[model samples]
Target: MVGLHLDDIDQRILAELSVDARLSLVTLANRVHLSRNAVKQRMERMERDGVIEGYTLRRGSGPSRRVTAIMLVYRADRMRGAGVVAELARIPEVVRCDILSGEFDLLVTVVAESMDRVGEIWEHVSALPDVENTVTSVSLSRPIDRP
Candidate 1:
């Protein structure tokens, strides 16, 4: 499926999946206005072409069940140091890490089981060699979360 082109239908399938990867083939097909088999074929082709990668679980944001925190990280060497990013990737609690422009070098998103765990992760991230400073803010509520 190299050099594969994604048509409008394929794009719709991807959009729906991005919102909820756990959607059943039948439900996905219904949302995309395609037959189940056709949708499945397109999904399989997209997977082969690397357009659709692996699926993952999005944990529930139940009160006290999960803690979401964002860390504003300033790197000592800025983007020139890739080591910090590599080390951040090894931490399972680090769900997202984005290199940013301006004041913050990295914006790290962590989802942990508890606030204590998030604090531990913060300590670990702060200890990384190239990490200069970090300011963490725990999320109180999530009104809109769209993938």
Candidate 2:
């Protein structure tokens, strides 16, 4: 909706929420120099207008770094139903999954604490009923990352 209009206050509210969604309405109101009720009304309007769709969690620095891997999955039946997707969702390590338009049917991104854990997830994916085969590659270094 390119035509959607957002005033300066709405922009400031979005900026603050992007930095820390946990900020209370009172704190946000103070930062935006508006009454608590005013801020609440603006936020509610943004939500209703779909300017603020939802909030997401950002991963914090943990003691152990996570290993990342990409798995290219080949399905036997070409994902006839939602069963395959449902099963993949059950695996927490699977961070992202996308349907591809090539030899592979699905591309899945997985993150785990160690190589062993990544391997375990790979094994689990390989054993899924709909999965015929999977080609996996572990990420050694990320030269560029956005978001």
Q: State every prediction's TM-score relative to the real structure.
A: 0.59, 0.57
Query: In model 1, what is the error at residue 120, expressed in angstroms?
Result: 0.8
Candidate 1's residue-wise lDDT over 30-126, tens digit each? 9878899999999888888877779988667663466789999999998796778767755656766788999999998887778999989999989
- Model 2 is weakest, by summed lDDT over 10 consecutive residues, at 1-10
Model 2 steric clash pairs = none
In order, candidate lDDTs are 0.81, 0.80
Candidate 1 regions exceeding 4 Å error are 1-64
